[model samples]
Target: MKTVALVYSQHTAQTAELGGRIAAAWGSEVVYLDPDTTRLEDWMKYERFILGTPTYFDGELPDSWDEFLPELEDADLSGKKVAVYGLGDQQHYPVSFADGVGLLASYMEELGATIVGETSTEGYSYEHSVAERDGRFLGLVLDPTNQPELTDQRLAAWLEQLKVAFAG
Candidate 1:
């Protein structure tokens, strides 16, 4: 199995919690990296990555992600595999739910990374989201504040999908 890095902001409680669950489910092959402390060079060590973020203030990326943007942009992720997951409250922020996932995935794609692990939009009640592309979410979207019950199942399925995508 390829080494997978699960990068996320430790500042956000929900995002951090979800990242932990994902890393745990992914077993020993996955390592957790906090965007706040992880160096830009460290990101290049992993060929496959799972990025997590929490949407803040009208679909904006969190402070940690904002600060890390320059390093992420500078990194050459060509031919790398990346999957994004985001935390949002569909009930409260339906208009821009999980927008952070879409934003991050777009940036990675622009850097020549292959974004994978798209998930269906079913079972989610959201007015609209940038994360949705052709009826599927760009990656996993978890709402721990609202739809907490589905998080486990969603993570399980997304990890399985990542295993296949990373293998290829």
Candidate 2:
């Protein structure tokens, strides 16, 4: 199956770094695409997708994601499996931690894709997030700025979750 990682980042490159880790965990041929250079057509060739982005001010995706999502409206992603991940400064934006995850995930969900990588909110200290549903994040939420030490462990666990989610 073809897998791709589409990433968008501004300022800190933590979102890109997280994409790399996810690609590595997949242990397969995974193509990496950055928003500026990535074409919506290129995304259509993949069966599995891993999308990452940094949450902008309050609860929103970066400019690139804003530009990219609408492009996907014409693409048919039915039956595709997607895993979403995001970076955020939970301390500063606790009320909307990794909110872009929700925005992005919603677009994918609308496109008829199945979203994997849902994670618990246990280790996080955020007050609210658009990404949260039923006490769980829509995808993996990592805080390289506040809890860098937990990134590896969280990624490992989420990777395991993806394996199971993808299998059944």
Please provide, for model 1 over 1-168, each residue's C-alpha lDDT reduced to its tens digit, 9 standing for 90 to 100: 988999998888888888888887789999888888888888888899999999998999998888888887767899899999998899999999999999999999999999999999999999989899999999999998898899889989988899999998
Decoy 1 TM-score against native: 0.95
Candidate 2: tens digits of C-alpha lDDT, residues 23-98: 7777765777777667778777777777888889999788888777777887888988888888888899999899
**Candidate 1 segments exceeding 4 Å error:** none
lDDT on C-alpha atoms for all candidate structures? 0.91, 0.81
In candidate 1, residue 100 scores what lDDT? 98
TM-score of 2: 0.90
Q: RMSD of each candidate?
A: 1.1, 1.9
Lowest summed lDDT over 10 consecutive residues: which window, candidate 1? 67-76
